[model samples]
Target: MSGGDGQPRDGSGADQPQPGRSEAEESRRGAAYGFTAYAVWGLFPLYFAALKPAGAWEILSHRILWTLLLCLVVLGLRRDLVWLRDLARRPRLAGGVTAAALLIGVNWVVYVAAVLNDHTTEAALGYFLNPIVTVALGVLVLRERLRPLQWVAVAIGALAGVYLSVAAGSVPVIALTLAFSFGGYGLVKKKVGVSLTAMQSLSAETLVLGPIAVVMLAVLTVRGDTTFTTDGAWHMTLLVLAGVATATPLLLFAAAARRVPLVTIGLLQFITPVLQLLCGVLLLHEHMSTARWTGFAIVWLALVVLTVDTLRHRTGLARARAAELADITP
Candidate 1:
């Protein structure tokens, strides 16, 4: 995500030419895209639920295979295969992309398993905890220093984990696995400084995993357990549409990131988890005991602290930039 200094001045020395209007329009458009992307992500439980009779492994394999095919077609049409040559020359980046592929594959399988097994609420909780996990990973892996509020937020998050574990009589393994896997994936992508477009990145990652997915499908076929052929046209279509479903939000998110501020994207990220939680409680009718609710509440509190810190930090940066500009002006 990119951001401006919140100041749109021109050489004319007057904030005219309707720059503010154009910026406002751009921001509005980006926000719309971001909202749609997150909304789609939030409603994924319903989509996965509809793909029944196909186990998690089957769904994951088809998702990978079809997504890779779709991405290849799109890239070919756009003549965007130059990145492949560039990636071939960078061994470290190639390794990072491979690691990213594996991590995301783990994430996809675990998520499918959670949704299929009616653990949608747990899946939602995992996403809700994702930001906290990312922050922890930055501190641990990147040796980044945290702000005071961030430390407080992390401490609160830890307390919530303890409470949840004690209340449930065990660790929330599904949630933690989802959070850590995704966090690690993000870290790897960041370290690699991925320059690929959304489609290109998806293509690269899926290409790495395509062989495994093919092998999985072949084994399923040998065992007469494949649903792609046995399932009717409707089921087949849904499975095939998985590629479109997977890529659309990602493309939208990339568009939004280019047009909007990082802070706006950060705020929008919460929409997905919030919607997922609602879907689990309302649509899926997943049980949310008092203990679970309490744990979620604590996590939300931590998020509130973290968000406040972020906003304040952004505001401070904006003010500092304005002050510097004023000092340099005639």
Candidate 2:
């Protein structure tokens, strides 16, 4: 959900404060946004599952195209048309965003396919693995330090991955792909700093990818290989609604990213995979073998450790801040 500081990962600098808001209030708002975003993301199995008759490619294209249209409208409303101009001035930044777009786009296609292909359990596992992946990225790539319990959580996560692969008699490719792609996406976005807000960044990513989405949709239509050509109005409506599905959670995520610490966002991400596991097991009727359950239990235990550590840290920090304020009082 966010880097530890909830600030831009780009290493550029601090955000200029909005005059009216207190930092405490902003963090509260951020936590709310982060929770909402993850909750919506957790329910995405229903969204992708409903896109029957359209393959993942078709669904992804519709999502991109519609999301692009929606972003354009929103940007227009905000009068934020300067993305292109700003990118033009910074070719390296454009390249970075393009790379990020591809990672996320690939992640999207794979996830949609997983949902429709009855690999929702794998998909859910993938997201559960993602925060651990993100934390690992922080340590390895950014040279960040981890608390002892945080390191223990990461180590346990590694064991979970190994157990799932060994017990399942196959590598958990879907879960690994999802975790790595999204983890890498977060890493790159942070590295790029806050040159662009989340909306602007997504707008630019879709813009870069939009032409290809158009061509792909057009080709599929011409070849009679697309849902739009064969499906009824309801299907088409759902397809177009992919834009709404895509945009809303992302917008909320952007809002949250600005307001919360990355670790806080990370902890809240549990909402998503937990919901997804429910959808996969209870709703989709996927079998949950004892071994699979064991694997999940290990991961869940790791999350419990991580969550407890994070909560304690925050509580201690809050008490310290309160004492500081008290000392300053008349």
On lDDT, the candidate that comes out on top is 1
TM-score of 2: 0.87
Candidate number achieving the greatest TM-score relative to the actual structure: 1
Scored by lDDT, model 2 comes in at: 0.80
Q: In candidate 2, where is summed lDDT lowest over 10 consecutive residues?
A: 3-12
Q: Would you list the C-alpha lDDT of every candidate in the order shown?
A: 0.82, 0.80
Model 2 stretches astray by more than 4 angstroms: 1-33, 256-264, 319-330
Which digits, one per residue and each the tens of the lDDT, describe model 1 over residues 116-218? 8988888888888888999999999999999999999999988998999999999999889888888888898889884676677788889999999999989
Error of 2 at 58 (Å): 0.5
All candidates' TM-scores?
Answer: 0.93, 0.87
Candidate 1 — which residues are off by over 4 angstroms?
1-21
lDDT string for model 2 (164-261, tens) is 99999999998898888888887887787668866677678888889989999889888888977467999989998887777677666666776777
